[model samples]
Target: MNQPFDSDLPNIDAPAIGPPTTDPVPQPFEVKFATRVDRLPPYMFGRINNSLYQKRRAGDDVIDLGMGNPSDPPDPSVIQKLADAAADPGNHGYSKSNGISNLRREVASKYYRLYGVRLDPDTEVMSCLGSKEGFSHMCLALMGPGDTAIIPSPYFPVHMYGVILAAGNVVALDVADSEMFLRNVAYTCEHMAPTPKVLIVNYPHNPSSAVIEPEFFVEVVRLAKKYGFMVIHDFAYADVAFDGYRPPSFLAAKGAKDVGVEFTTMSKGYNMAGWRVGFCAGNSEMIRGLGTVKGYYDYGMFAAVQIAAIVALRETDTNVEKQSRIYQGRRDVLVSGLRRLGWDVTPPKAGMFVWAKVPEPWASSMSTMDFALKLLEEGNVAVSPGSGFGQGGEGFLRMSLVENEQRLRQAVRQISKCLG
Candidate 1:
């Protein structure tokens, strides 16, 4: 052993292996993410609500009014179409990523009949797995680093998050009141960075349930033209209005096609959330942009689902009208019950959620999360806190009308008791 000893060699009889001569184990790949993703706050609402659901499963009689997931089923004809299509052996295959031509044509025809907005099915209409996916993909296709998107505050999270995911900036404008929404848009054009290349709008708005008029849309079109920004309107709840006040179509505005596109979903109107069928119509260029991006990503929705959606669009209006009536009745019941318990709640004119201001004693000390947590623990009633939408949503709560009139009344009763 001593004849030609090497300095780096370990003795043959060394009691244990010496420290391994290798670089430290590499950190997990997940530890390194895009800086943009690292900047996002944890999605607290979903995290907390999921935990609450587990608790409720453990014997609590929880009345969940938190999510806007529809509890109803599609019409008989729609279901029949899905069944019929599925029964055909030849129907099982990859679908057209841009959507079937017949489905696109049906959507265009419906648009013309309902809103008087004539769309070229082949050029301007494209189907989506869902409106959410369509909107997100559209953002990625049209926006990029250094670009800015204008979003209304208290909006659906997808609108803002999509821009962020695309590595673009968002300028949140408050649309709590109709006048304020218009004012903020005009003001944003004058003051935002990168001059805001895109503007996102929603009506029969989620959380606030605010409906915009044709005049407001005209103003939006004018701004889009002047500022050279594309307008994307999410009309998911387009057919869910009440009290005889139909929401106006952005496509109905004079210059809408010059600067705008609108998204519609079967999820809200036909209870097809699980099916995930939606369509985008308007602005041929934008539609093509979305389609091109989607083509590289997915094989499109299932053929049977697309076929069923055609039936849903053509035959489900009556079901939609009935659902709207039921929601209206529930809204009235819940509003009256809350008012009787000394909390003022205005009935929403559209959409499925009631946006209510938190009451006095807790309003001062309680953040939306705190209030929502207390409600879940103390009253066994789950509601979506306002701050989940955005900063401007603080101090408010969104109660979904997905529950029945009896369940909504029960939720109000529980809240009343908890307050006392």
Candidate 2:
């Protein structure tokens, strides 16, 4: 019987295996993703990005103003520190997931120096791969099914998706007017059952470049306390203000440490985006939760990067301020050019984007998504459509000031020729 078990099959040395072995050749099993991944909608920018890729491939000199990526290099001194630290053999190993004591201390020092907010490096401060990584993990740490978060309307993708991925719901309130936003937050908290678990605020906001005064955060703290919710301030653009406008720190509000944490990174002002040095401070317990999540997910930022980040934070304030000035200059050039095009463009007081309305016949004739495609197709210039942000951003385009003055000027010329 044992010998006969294989008798109907092909012989071990046979050149032809017994007439096609009719059980149908082994096929790959179907793959199913987790429910959380399934919950996500299709990529919002896929259409625009795909066309951009095709255009670039076709040898078109398409000027890209889509992402808020910095086009400049970090300060020379900071680069040197990175090289020097990288050269040291001791700096090549795994770093503390909570960041080194010195770097944490530096973060606390900056908090106190810039915002008059005290933070304990040992407990209140931790560095992240980047603020977005920290923010997403923080949402996971605090959220679960049935939990809810309140975010700004026309949110940056991560703001809404992070909560959604953590199995939480969102209430996005319009943030064009700060007072109205605060009123809506109170209204939602007052009207909704169980209320929201977290309230996220971004000053010098992305996509819209909305600015809020220091008093705005005081109201936010008051509402957080009244609503019994926590706060998460995305202070990504904290260092990139213009026309003497200083973005307020949520941590600067009294009792902010009781209910929240603030996230900051060197990506914008210091132009160290690719280096991925991010900081979180305030609400030590919340910081601890984020640290626990991060510990399981990552060892930490690279040791050499951390070492260099310390130097960047401690020694590059002048350079950081200089970079802001450079951005302000670029902002002026782009805003002026757009205004000349008869688009309703507001010059932002801070942040790296110019959120301009889709002008003229196009605004009524097409959606922002279509308008963006037309610009890319005809103008050879790329900009993000407002719909990419959310429903509130539907009638606008968010153009970055990342390109240099010359490229920005050229982009405007291209846009004019395309539309004129």
For candidate 1, lDDT tens digit of each residue in 1-420? 355776798678659868989999797666678887975778959755885878877989888888999987888898999999999987899987889999999999988988898999999899998999999999989999999998888868998899999999888888868788777887888886558899999998887888878899998898898888999999998989899989898998987988979999999878999999999999999999998899899998989998998888877778899989988898898888878887757788899988888888888997888898888888889988989999888988898988899898899889987878
Writing each residue's lDDT as its tens digit, candidate 2 over 220-266 gives 88888888999999999999999989898999999899989999998
RMSD of 2: 5.5
Name the lDDT of candidate 2: 0.92
Against the unseen true structure, what C-alpha lDDT does each candidate score?
A: 0.88, 0.92
**Most TM-score-accurate candidate:** 2
TM-score of each: 0.92, 0.94
Clashes of 1: 0
